[model samples]
Target chain A: MAKEPEQEFVTMTPQQKKARRSRSLALALALAAFVIVMYFVTFVKMDPSILNRAM
Target chain B: MAFVDKSALGDADFRLSEATAADFVALLKPRVMSLVVFTAFVGLAVAPAGMNPFLALVSIVAIAVGAGASGALNMWYDADIDAVMTRTASRPVPAGRVTPREALAFGLVLSGLSVMTLGLVANWLAAAMLAFTIFFYAVVYTMWLKRSTPQNIVIGGAAGAFPPMIGWTAVTGSIGLESVVLFLIIFLWTPPHFWALALFKSGDYERAGVPMMPNVAGDASTRRQIFVYSLLLAASGVLPWALGHASAFYGVGAALLGIGFVHYAWRVLAQDPADAGMKPAKALFGYSLLYLFAIFTFVLVDHLAMRMIG
Candidate 1:
């Protein structure tokens, strides 16, 4: 497996850091989506809207 | 990654030499420093009194630097054992990329810088906590308990649990019961968290002769201790909201997470030895990360919400 970004630090410009941040956010969202799908199928079918409501 | 070949740097015609600025940087154990910084930040954010933003920043930076200093000193002292352990074989001092004297100098400098900066930027109370944290990690854990007994993680965990209280002191300039509660949560959480890793990394301790729980007591005893500590950790997880340091949102979230922790512990204890049973221990280890993150995250969030609404 590839090393996680937070596990190592590399010097980068502000723009490079922005790009990296976006990539990380995208990956995290994708993983969260996968978990949500798995839960709905295998476990509970809760509404995603509940998150906003809880806030 | 292949562990055996990881330390080729050690064989680069390596004689113990003075470490450069970069090697000294690595000695601080930046990975552990991040977790310490995060929890400490949460503690500062949730403290009853407000602190100056720049001073708060300075305090957090100083605390992290102090933690790194402690790590460097530990690496310097433990270089002999570290060179033999696969996991730590590549550390600067152990790998001969750095000399012990160089690491010692670097740690001493950082320890002084962090403590002095914290005192100037924050209150003396916060600075004292930072200094004490470095001393506890360097002297108590690294010098004392690490070699003396297998219960090192249990006692030495106090060193790791100091961040939240330190952060709290930075803002309040005095210790609060709530801050102590935060410390207790991490204190209780450490044993099981570390013991699980020790369970799987049994060979590492045996090879290094570190007297880890698995190496000294036995696997069953380690597992039982993990379960007991997890039980206490779960109880402490709910204490913040129960004592009214937090609000309902935190209370409910903690209860659920506490149940999840207990469930993970149960699976680790009752499961049979096989590929199948590995999953639970692994799950507990993984969730344990989330457990600490969520608890501190909740504390910060709930505290922020109250501040805004009030």
Candidate 2:
């Protein structure tokens, strides 16, 4: 009789899945923060008058 | 989605070792990164020219990432020695949580990302310093000096000291005497601080085949060197105040702190080598950490006060 090839799958545990999700969330937050900071910096650089107005 | 390959999954020997997010974080050496961030922040904050708050934040984040990248690369390269050392045996790379190849790739990616981001958001000078610091720590220190010379920490300390200069350059687009003074403080302080650790951990260094001061120079020589560096560090600590970069308040505080540092170093120097406790060396090691934090805190406080009053 000829043998058939078997397919195997690897799955993460629930805890591992939760940890991956949290890590992804943290990375997303860090990226968002970086974008926000860059935007704010660009705004300030483009308008020196903004500082005087704040004061 | 899981990135596991189907082919890799089919291998009977393949077993995931439960490496968590924390393991990846550990590869960054968070404690060292925190110190890097704090010192870099102080450098940026104390710069004479004002910077956009958002720009300052970006520079700090970039520098922190660069520091973390250096740490990861160091762990990758030093895995062999780290595995042998009791203190570092549990680090991610050595403990089998993070593979060397993965750590190397992570470090290289982060290093490129950090330098590019810093150059785009800040000045090229700061970015250059960041690149050099990473190279110095990972290549110059970890690959070359660590195994070859007893003066490894002495020269490698420059990598740790460059953050403040990078922060300053990010603001002013140039290095100044003030920033150089900040660099000198850290540069000179490194020997005494690390030598104290080496005194107690000579056995570990010997076992790992690292040429730390105590292992190569003998206890008496290492002790003497610690005292000399402590004296130099003490003088360097007061330079900001002496040069009138900081106020009289900072001067008095720094002087007192320097005195305490010298006292501790003196104790380490005078202690009998055969003594079982090694208390003085331990005390000096602990105090060195406090001394650095307190000095930098004073710098931050003085800078803020000046800004407010002016």
User: Whose lDDT is greatest here?
Assistant: 2
TM-score of 1: 0.79
Q: Compared with the true structure, what per-residue lDDT tens digits does model 1 show for residues B1-310?
A: 1123324445444332334445666898988999999999988998888776756776787789899999999998999999998889999988876778778988998899788867766678888888888998899999999988998988999999999999999888899999999999999999888887777777888988899997998877887888899889988988988998889898999889988988898887876765434677778888899999998998889989988989
Each candidate: chain B TM-score? 0.92, 0.95
Fraction of native Cα contacts reproduced by each candidate: 0.00, 0.17
Q: Which pairs of residues have clashing backbones in candidate 2? A: none
lDDT score of residue B104 within candidate 1: 92
Residue B267 shift from truth in candidate 2, angstroms: 0.4
Each prediction's DockQ?
0.01, 0.21
